[model samples]
Target: MGERYEYVPHRLLRRRVRDIASGVEGELMAVISENVSGVGAEHWVELAYVRGPSGREFTTSVGNIESAPGGEAG
Candidate 1:
């Protein structure tokens, strides 16, 4: 069997993120890094580090990320 990959939406990457502590919204600069794994049958988790325009970074985890429409997984 071959390893399966997931696709992240480019739009989502560009969306602004709000800081929970101060309620400030910052622009998402880039997806700095990502880690993905299958936890069980039909279940997966992805952890991604996103950089802000101000050079701040934050970690976010998402589950069951699907491939983008008309796009290939990476």
Candidate 2:
């Protein structure tokens, strides 16, 4: 793994994470596969789905988050 790679794939899903940029703490709801099409090509990527305290759902890059403090029971 690279020195800056902090995303632990197996352990992050359904866990709590804090968005380092926004400071919004929420549950790491899921990692979903998304298909994208480009110029004569196609690819898939995993996006992190998160639910905030207000019940809003949004997708963010896994690199933008970290494990929430006080462990996973949030």
Q: How does candidate 1 score on lDDT?
A: 0.44
Q: Who wins the TM-score comparison?
A: 2
Model 1 spans > 4 angstroms off: 19-24, 29-42, 53-56, 62-74
How far residue 14's Cα lies from its native spot in candidate 1, in Å, is 2.1
Local distance difference test, per candidate? Answer: 0.44, 0.72
Q: Write the per-residue lDDT of candidate 2 for residues 15-68, one digit (tens) a residue.
A: 888877788888888776566545665566667778999999887776787898
After TM-score superposition, the amount by which residue 59's alpha carbon in candidate 2 deviates from its true location, in angstroms, is 0.8
Question: Please, what are the lDDT tens digits per residue for candidate 1 over residues 26-52?
Answer: 444344323333564553445444454
RMSD to true structure for each model, in Å: 9.2, 7.4
Best candidate per lDDT, number?
A: 2
Worst 10 residues of 2 by lDDT: 1-10
